[model samples]
Target: MTEFPEGIESGFAAARQIADAVLLEGYVLYPYRASAAKNRLRWQFGVLVPPEYTAQGGEHSHQRTECVMEARQDDRLAVELRFLRVQRRTVERATATGGFEPVERLELADRVLVEWDEAVEERIEILVPVEELMGEGVQQGFRLPGVGETELLREDGTAVGRLVRRREQVDGVVRLKAEELPGPYRAQRLTAVVENASTWIPRRRTPREEALPRALVSAHLLLGLEHGRFLSVTDPPEWARPAVERCRNEQTWPVLAGPDDGCKVILSSPIILEDHPKVAPESLGTLYDATEIDEILALRTAALTDEEKREARGTDARAGAVIDLAESMPPEVLERLHGAIRGLREISAGTPDGEQPWWDPGNDPAVDPERDEVLVDGHAVAAGSRVLLRPGRRRTDAQDLFLAGRTGVVEAVLHDVDGSVHLAVTVEDDPGADLWRAQGRFRYFQPDEVTPLEES
Candidate 1:
């Protein structure tokens, strides 16, 4: 198996910068420090480790993470794991070896100065589910039914312990081989099966080299599915820096982020690297739509909530398209998709000026109208006419600032030299309304975005 690439170059300059920020956000310096807690929370994507695994200083002492991959029937997946190890420590003599060998008052352990030596290792595992590769109900890889025990071994190659099976438990009997997938799976998840992996080993100069085994630090994974490349943060090996950047410049980016669960191991949340450093992912409905997830969400939101409809973002013509397609989807799936969309908004919510040509509404000034007249939803409006305010469909700082369905009466109708019409609305609710800024302290809206109210 091979490693994955550092995915495609970012979509645009803004995207590229954002991608790099996500990668480096929580990353800490080598040997790791304690002052910053955010760095310690980083690199949680695609991590898979055994039950009860926890790191000594950071994540897991003997930890690993994985991605769930499924390739086209014609394609395959290549995997590789890379990391640095504290192989050995060089200890200097802490105390002088004087002629006398007696000293109850002095703690000799303080005399040794320890410096660690580092090394690198790589391991590979390839998986092809029986259901996908072979026919259904065919159990070729599984071992005969029997009880199996997890054995602990010492460096001397001797058994130190075994997890004894209980008298009356359904899962007490462990099979020599892991259970096979039930059947016909498009994607089969596989976790690492580590044996006797530990991060720290006690020094034993009195007898042996060390009392335990360990996993290395700053691990990197290069995984390639039949479709694209996948890799995580962590400085590249000195030899691959230029090559790595070259790869980054050519890669298409999709954010792979997760929650801050405060655990040693976590699964990644798929997102688009967004602007705004301080905003958390939970607030942004800025999820990346690569695998038709947006389509799925469109279908699910067909049944709208009263609150959703009240929010101007939900009233757009696009809302209807997502409904009929989603009626049968489960509520849980819809909830996660809702979270994804909310996360997506966090990016659009900010007011940042950059080379974002892809933005829905250009950041440039509004267009001048051809004629001056005041009309809302095709209804003629004059001073003292009460109406409802509909938020602008275009997502921008000005649009977001407007409240949806607000009740207000036209105080005056004004136009500019360009013949652009503005409705001067005085909202009963806004005591601070001023007739200065377009609609005074209230907001100005094009006649197209407001709903006209007749009498009461």
Candidate 2:
């Protein structure tokens, strides 16, 4: 219980804490991007609107997120809403192609710069001599599919069949908004447009121009009981300061500019505190999840600095424990464990409980084989294996041709063109060997049918 030494055992309290954890989990990229890439998928939780929603230019509101809180025995709860609004300052960016003309990609130079051009016309227009679209090509019998908006007729009623259309920008901002609902936490809701980026967002502006935006992506809130000497959701016991401080310091979303104007976005984790005498800020510690910790370390995300780590350890005993365990592991062992665990997790993804996982070889539990790498009595049994057949059933018509408990030398393990594998074996003692084809008369079997006699 390093960080929150409080007795925040209530459901409301725990939810609050988890909200904070998720907000900062992938809020920014490693090395902290003023602009980030789409592939990274940061700001993954509680997303609101993206830039596209704000495309029309004026202040706009979009997207709604509702958080429902249960009423206490007293039927009241105090919840403080908190989050960051990334302020996007409009600015111009240019293309290396010089102008919009189609130019070879290689011809573009990096030195070319252009200011953010607002109100750029998206369509081109020209006057033609004909009443309808026509060209010099074959005419009388050639059929043409018609196109264009209903011809805009002149005041004289003559039609100008010229086409009108729109072009897409290589890059531009859209509407995005995330606002808290005005009602109580017990039934809170929100409303707005531009809930999330319709398309994966890339670095669309200069580092100086890139914004966190005013949205719910960085929201944090705390909801707890108000009666029986309960503290405000906005305030925590003095003992909890250090834990909060460490969290902001490590996550490091510096306030470039804002009313409070600080680097860190501050908010308490959501929680439900109660009237119990045992509960207090100094006694609170967060719940631990080993699986989540594994992912955080594997990502090697933020909070890695020695100072940050120390601060984190001071606040979270569980985090410290896992950090220590990971730090103490041998590099090679750690790598192997991480890789194998990651792979296993991938195989089990979307799998329901009690079913054979996708990674299980042969799709059968009767033969539990670990195939990525197999170790058999200090040696491997792969190709050219010498195996003994298990005593098993043979149909009456096939009884004389194959024998059970017989030794066989594995020949080429053939793979079907479609990638199915079969262990090819030749029974050296087969009395009918002369009747079968040459090459020692091989037989194919599933991996479960043959047991390795010994390492070969």
Best by TM-score: 2
What clash count goes with each model? 37, 53
How many Å off is the CA of 7 in candidate 2? 10
Top candidate (lDDT): 1
lDDT of each: 0.34, 0.34
Tell me the TM-score of model 2: 0.26
In candidate 2, where is summed lDDT lowest over 10 consecutive residues? Answer: 116-125
Model 2, 1-456: lDDT tens digits are 112212222433445344444344443332222222431334444333335444432212232212222223332223233443332212222234432222111111211111111111111111111112112211111111222222121224533122132212122122112122233332211111122233425353423223223233443333332222222222334543333233211111211111122211122322222222121232122223222434345336333665444533432233445445545655565445343322333333446776655454355444422232223345455555777765344423355245567887666554443545566566767776646536445576655656777554
Candidate 1 segments exceeding 4 Å error? 1-20, 24-269, 273-371, 382-385, 390-405, 410-426, 435-449, 453-456
Rate residue 325 of model 2 by lDDT. Answer: 59
lDDT value for model 1: 0.34
TM-score of each: 0.25, 0.26
Query: What are the candidates' C-alpha RMSDs?
Result: 22.7, 24.7
